[model samples]
Target: MTYIGRFAPSPSGPLHFGSLIAAFGSYFQAKSQQGQWLVRIEDLDPPREMPGASSLILNTLESYGLHWDGSVIYQSQRHQRYQEQIDSWLASGLAYYCQCTRKQIKQGGGFYLGTCRHKSQLTPEGCSVRLHVKQAIEQFTDQKHGVITIPHQLAQEDFIIKRRDGLFAYNLAVVLDDIDQGVTEVVRGADLIEPTGRQINLYRYLNQPEVSYIHLPLALDEHGNKLSKQNHAPAVDTHCAKETLIKVMLFLGFTLPDDFQSASIEQMIEWGCQHWSLQQLPNSLASSTL
Candidate 1:
């Protein structure tokens, strides 16, 4: 089977150093194996999305020599596809309409206890759709981290596939998109590891082939918090793309040649593909200062 990987980013803000780490890690992991690396713009949430952030992200990737294999996919354009899957699940009795509020779930111990699983007749206007979750997957092996076990309550809970506001949930959309794209592997940040079992369960529900996973270590700020756009982590400097690329390489635990400082961006990337190794990556959170 052809090894296919992807770099998916939400268009909520500019790509930061943390974002670059995920992009490059996925890009080189695919390139190293002569696999196809695809880019997907996860523009699912309209309220949280920033104007023109998708274009800026694509431009930044291009500037850093991280060109992808095909035309970028936008989740906003795939609403029909997402809805179709939800409809199929609803029809098959695999899912149902839920009227449970966030406060209600939190008050009920933070795990949804299938309050609305029997309420399929609930009006869709004020309801979100949730999977029945008969097969709760509690464990999966990560390519980098190995043998991860999810909390039983989280794994067993009936999770929402669509929001009360009529938006597709990330877990539902991401799994369907990966299946549609024929992705063989998912290389992303470790921060997403908690959801792997949930995504895997979705794959099982759809009877689709499961993809392999490699979650790279998250980049953390000086305060030990994950570097994210919400935390005001600065966008990567495109003006110094080469330097930033070098820093990313070092963070991934690659040892460059003494003369690599003078190498062009393309050359550095070429070298990276030729030398990429999963074993070289650091398992702990990487400091953003690097």
Candidate 2:
């Protein structure tokens, strides 16, 4: 099958080191396989988005020579499409309106107990939409992490597709967007492994083919915390693009020549693509200090 990959990021902040690692890894992986690599701006949550973050992210990627295929899709512009999918799910009894708050769910033992599954008359204003998960994706094989399994109870929970704040949940939006973009492989950070099972089930519910997954190691700080925008990780220096690219390539387990360190960005990237090894990537990056 023709391989297609994507790097989807939320517009909550500018591109940081962790973000670059994900983008660079995905770009190299796709280029190595001669696959199409696309970029998607996950701007569904308006309240969390920073002003100009979307443009800044695109600019950063370009500065690092990570040009994406086709036009970059913005989740904000696809509200109608998401609504259409939700309506279809509701009509088919695959999903239902949920009125249970976080506190109420926690009080009932954390996982949702289907309290609102039978409540068809619940108003949609303050309600969220949840998938009525009848089947479970027990296990899936990851490209890097090998076999992964989901617990029966966790798999059976009626996960929310839309939030009470009128925003489409990440689980729902990502699955739909992947299908829409024909993403054949999802290469992202290992932090998202938990959601893999949920997304796999979503594909089955929507009658869409499942995509392959490869989760890269996450860059962490000295305290062992993942480098993230929420953790206030500094944005990557686009002015030092070549140096940054070399560092990311090394992080992905590529050994470079001494003279190549002084090579141009394009040459380094070409060498990286030619020598990219999926087996060399460590399960997790110990720290970002390296």
Candidate 3:
């Protein structure tokens, strides 16, 4: 089977150094294997999305020479596909309508207590949808992290597939999109490691082959917090694309010659793919400074 990888970013803000780390990691991984590297705009949450952020993201990738394999996909345009899966699950008793509120779940010890699993007959109005979770998957092997075990409570919980506010949940959308795209592997930041088991469970629930995973270390700030849009991490300067790419490569544990500072973006990227090694990557945060 042809290796296929992707970088799916939410349209919450413009690209930052942390974002570049993930993009470059996935790009080099796919290119190294002579595989297809795809890009997808995860615009599922409208309230958090910044206007024009998607276009800005694509332009930045092009500016930095991280060109993807084909036309970019936008999750906002795939509602029908997401809805079809949800409808099928509901009809087959694999998922059900949920009326429990966030506060109620919190009061019930944070993990969902399956309070609504038997409430399939409940009205859909003002209710979220949750997977019945008959088979709880608590562990999976990561290409980089090896065997990872999830807490039993979390694994057994009947997680939501659609929010009460009429938005699709991230786990459901991501898994379904990967299946639809024929993705063979998922390569992203380690910050998302916690969701691996849940996504794997969804894959099994759908009876689709599970994709391999490789989560790159996160990019943290001086205070040790992961750099993120929520923390107002500044957008990376595309004018310094070459410099930034070199810096990112170094953070990923690459050892380049001093002359590399003058290398063009294309040259740097070609060299990166040729020398890509997962063993050199740090298992913890990449760095506190870019």
Best lDDT goes to which candidate?
1
lDDT of 2 by residue, 1-290 (tens): 77889999999999998889999899999999998999999998888899999999999998888889999999999999999999998988888898889999899888888899999798788899999878777788988878977777787788999999889999989999999999999999888887888999999888899999988888887787899989999999989998888888888888889898788888888888898878889864233444
Tell me the lDDT of model 1 at 162.
97
Best-to-worst order by lDDT is 1, 3, 2
lDDT of 2 at 8: 96
Listed per candidate, the RMSD to the true structure in angstroms reads 1.3, 1.5, 1.3
Q: Tens-digit lDDT track for model 3 on 166-211? A: 9999999999999999999999888887788889889888889999
Candidate 1, residue 216: the lDDT equals 88
lDDT tens digits by residue: candidate 1, 1-290: 89899999999999999999999999999999999999999999999999999999999999999889988999999999999999998999998999989999999899899888887469789899998889889989888778888999999988889999999999999999999999999999888987888899999888898999998888888888888989989999999999999989998989999999999999999999999999999765334454
Error of 1 at 24 (Å): 0.2
- Candidate 1 residue-wise lDDT at 5: 93
**Better by lDDT, candidate 2 or 1:** 1
TM-scores, each model vs. reference: 0.97, 0.96, 0.97
Which residue runs does candidate 2 get wrong by more than 4 Å?
284-290
lDDT, model 2, position 65: 83
Q: Per-residue lDDT for 167 in model 3?
A: 99
Q: Residue 271: error of model 3 in Å?
A: 0.1
What's the lDDT of the predicted structure labeled candidate 1? 0.91
